[model samples]
Target chain A: MTPLPTWQRGMRGWWRRDPAFRRYLLREATSVAIGAYALMLLAGLGCLVAGPAAWQRWEGLILSPVGLLLQAVVFAAAVIHAVSWFRLMPLTIPPLGRPGRRLADGAIHAGAWAASALCSLGLLGWLVYGA
Target chain B: MTDPETILIEVLRWHPDTPEAPWWQSYEVPYRADATLLEALQTIKDDLDGTLTFRWSCRMAICGSCGCMVNGRPELSCHLLLRDLAPGPVRLEPLAHFPVIRDLVIDQQDFLDKLPAVGAYLVPAEETEAAAAAPAAPSRQTPAQMADYYQYAQCINCLLCYSACPQYGLKPDFLGPAALALMARHDADSRDHGQAGRRAARDADTGVWDCTLVGHCTEVCPQGVDPARAINRNKTASARDYVFDLLLPGRRR
Candidate 1:
């Protein structure tokens, strides 16, 4: 006769308990902030298509403290998303596979960060300084 | 020699014959500076509790048989010195994400099934080439070519990476780290022509696509085999294959 197997229950608290798992959970949660920002932009676009009455209401919502707080949260999540995404680029697309064309992880990370900074700065400049 | 100093060890206990469910059993083990954790278990089995059970063979990291959870991390019991985990009350359990066969032993059938699923073995490019070549002649491999897949080849199949992977805990069918790393190891090998055959396992939703690049597997590996690196690197390869498959369905090289 065979002995019955005894199974141990796994904890759902791994995200809260483990430091590595917590970081992974936080990285995944950034998508919520991105989705929130996308919805906000879509609302603004909808208001524009609906003309002045709807546009005024959208403008009020955009200028509200709550709206500003949401934007701040979204911006913070985007920055984290960008940094973590760039950090993972070295692993996803490695540096040393090719002969005579080796690049360090740091170089890859910095290149990605710089590209992101340039794109962000250009977009900010266009938003504020464009006529 | 003076009477050996003792330390407490808490090992998870379970038996099919016993009515009680799994529970921790603590033992006061005589400490020795040079003794590995496996030695402590041996002492417990020999002197203290003969009923206590765990698996170990090589008494070294090479066999990959002595893997268990120490302080919530997967490590080979034979590889860790008891002196390092001193000050009493070291917690021991079966490897995470695997069903316990008994005390510190886990049923490794899940891992065994995945090995063949991913085409873990190398497939020679030509069956006739082997017949034509001299029996004693060595297959040509430059130092550079050897280095490409050398790191991944060091995997001891300890399932330490599986225990470290949260993705495996969540989705058992994800073809977790060791198997995927082995897949990438053979895929990267210049001599192996098994990449095309392993494509189904690699390209599936449960393949490299499931890994979110947590990288804990690499950190916990006793042999320093970076399965996270292999999984993520293959993500790039998988993406390329996806694009190519779409562009030229029948023209894949």
Candidate 2:
């Protein structure tokens, strides 16, 4: 049997370094970050339930450089995750319109933006008005 | 006198066992204005590397056999040319959302299974009724009616939609674009009377509900099947049935 050329052996590297694989990595990384962020939120909730003092301590921890940095990283990952997920929104979700007349891509983005805005506003309301 | 053009193809490949199972493999080949991407791959395989493997037949895109990822999009290799892709490099890989069978090949067994689940083939209304046939009835159609489902009928079972589907990538069991589009084709046809088939096939996980309507499948279809529309329309049908369960009477249990 003829042996594979010296370069063909290297071409076999494609199995590991393909773009789909890289995209999968990016998608999964953001997902894992989001999961970790959720855990942090849950822990904060636990601290709040424990006592006011505990909630203050948790708030102080969140304010520290390391926690803020981690939060910033998760925020960035969340953005990446959003973009990837939205770009793929047309697939799993229902189509926004008729066959030939598809709804604008902006509408999908607008929906996401609206959801984010509502969440932000609610958070602000909780901190300012409710508290 | 003229200088010849060249197109570089970078293919992603992988083996199941290798820890570093996936990587990019490049091929530089002479370009021609009329050459299809599949033709380039064929040339590479024939002259350059026999180890390079992909499936092809009826090279004119009718067979729907030669589809893969072309520049991060699902496309028929036989229909796309390097000249259209342009100056330097065009990426080539197996279809997205499938396990690699080899270089530009994908595992299609799961995709095929959904076709059967949908009852894709025509089930003759009368198995033996030659005498009862409508005697040379005139074919009736207005242009507007044809326009409604025309583009969708042109699908040739190319798995490009499967590649474009993210749902299938994550859940291999998802009854994806082509099968659902094929189902929609039958359902859309005024002639078909396969009500039982649609009910059985349209489920929550593998059926119409599984689709998130990303619309990517429709965009990348070489035949312009508009699978997203078909899927959503069927999903609407399913949703309506779910809401009006009492009025619908029976069929789904």
Candidate 3:
């Protein structure tokens, strides 16, 4: 008997096929911006170590329009990354709370967001008042 | 608006004997507000085209036999009402990422083969000879223990998750969603002592690590089984295991 040919529908642009796929791609893409921000921070540290003059030069460049725009994009990506990460946090961990009474997913999200907000505010306050 | 009395269902048709590639064949099925897509397929098979092939059983969404692609989304045919997809053409095709057996039927042998590898069933703890000889009492579980695995137990083996998974489409070697979810189901069971044995499968390259958490599997699931969560949680477990194995080689389980 001849072997019947089964139609193999290849995955061509499968990531673009669905909204869920697009969202997953977006979540994964956030890491690129986060990586760029980390590199920028490292570069700043390098500038600081070099000299005050080098530090001033780096600061000026960062405060420029293009740099500010890049920072804004990075900030947006970071926010997206954080939110998506927190949303998926509950799934990665074991059921919270005492046995027979697990914490709701909302509780985890709330806790995560609260912690993030507090940290962001603390950093802002320290930069404004102490720095 | 187009005639509400009848709606066109565009079905992808193919046969191995025919040399022609798979093509769309439209059937104008009588519209019914309450009728399901399965019923419409039945109408086409019974009255319109007897040659039109598909699979269906226990039409109320149980038995998991009637899953197919509806409007490019993996869905249970019996669960979708014709009214919701009213006024025009609704595309019907075999589930994505699978080889079409015929019109609406895709070969599920791949998924079926992965089931046992993931250890989808409970593995009873080893018992003493005395205990084995004695009458086996039913394993009782607390509400908390049951809750750990209850949601995962709702999986009906519908294969919609496979269809929704782009990773599975791109790489067939990956264990995919439903199987991994089933692995999680058993791993979470209080009575199951098979976690160690199943760990290798879940910890492999083709395991939970393969999933990008697209989460369409959960969305497309008729039973609400979150395969993404199941697979992702296992990734955490696998990572922890990897760290432990690396740090304490002697204590590796």
Candidate 4:
């Protein structure tokens, strides 16, 4: 006797299949913007090392409409990445707090957001006053 | 609004003997407010069509045998009431990422084979010669200790997680969610000493690494067993083990 045909519903458009999958894909896709921003920063550092004239040229390009637009997109992506990362952080790590008492997931998220806010404010203060 | 007295349940049907492909065959199941999808299926099987086949054991969700795709999402048929999906067509299909055996029944041979492969059971701690000679005693655990793995222990091997997992659909070789969660369940048990033996399976490429944390496994789970969390926690453990194995090979646990 011949073997029966087992129906295989392949993973076609898997990301679109479920809301969770779509969110996962969106979170993963934000890395492209983050990586692009990192590369731009690296290039700016190279320009600074080259000469003052090169540095000025790089600065001008960064202050351009396209550059500002790209930066805005990257910033949005970074915010999304950071939030999603923090939300998932508790899951990846072992249960926090003492043996009997474990930290709530909300506490982890709040702690992460607080830390991020503190760092951002510190960076902003340094840029405005220290510089 | 459709007729309130009856609900249409569209079942994906397949047969080995037939030349036709798997197709949607709708049944008008007499709907009651409290009737579950399992009851509706039973109605179809008992009165409407005897050929319509699906797996169900405990009418409650404990058996985990009644899992199927209800309206494209993996769900326990016994748990979903007809009142919730009222007055319309409810599409039922075999769980995704599994080979269809018949109508609403999937071949769970792969998942069944993976259970022991991950060492989802406990291995007692090595006993001293004197202890070994004595009569065996129960290795007790405190409430706190039990809490560590109690959530994972609730897993009914429903296969809904596997159905919800796109990674399992894409890469069938991936150990998938429920089995990995079971592995974590045993690993977290205070009485279980099987972590060292189960390390190889957990550290493999197709192990915890394959999960991109889509997290639908946790969502679709009727038992509230967070397989995504279990797999990710093991990812951290596996990463630590990797570093330890590299830096101090002999000292690696």
lDDT of 3 by residue, B91-118 (tens): 9889999998788888898988888899
Kindly give the stretch of ten consecutive residues in candidate 2 chain B with the minimal lDDT sum: B122-131
Give the DockQ ranking, best first: 3, 4, 1, 2
Best-fitting candidate, scored by DockQ: 3
Docking model 3 quality class: medium
* Model 3 residue B134 lDDT score: 70
User: Which digits, one per residue and each the tens of the lDDT, describe model 3 over residues A59-126?
Assistant: 99999999999999999999999989998898788667775788989999999999999998999999
Give the chain B TM-score for each candidate: 0.93, 0.85, 0.95, 0.95
* Count of backbone collisions within predicted model 3: 0
The C-alpha stretches of model 2 lying farther than 4 A from their native spots are: A1-131, B1-5, B14-23, B123-145, B248-253
Residue A29: error of model 1 in Å? 0.8
Per-candidate TM-scores read 0.88, 0.62, 0.94, 0.94
Superior by TM-score: candidate 2 or candidate 3 = 3
In candidate 3, which residue pairs clash?
none
Highest lDDT, which number?
4
For lDDT, candidate 2 versus 4, the one ahead is 4
Classified by CAPRI criteria, candidate 2 counts as incorrect
- Per-model clash counts, in order, read 0, 28, 0, 0
User: Distance from true position, residue B80, model 1, in Å?
Assistant: 2.8
Decoy 3 TM-score against native:
0.94
Question: After superposition, which runs of candidate 4 have C-alpha atoms over 4 Å from their true positions?
Answer: A1-5, B1-3, B129-135
Q: On a 0 to 1 DockQ scale, where is model 3? A: 0.67
lDDT per residue for candidate 2 within B174-237, as digits (tens), equals 8988888878777765555675567767855779888766566777788878898788778777
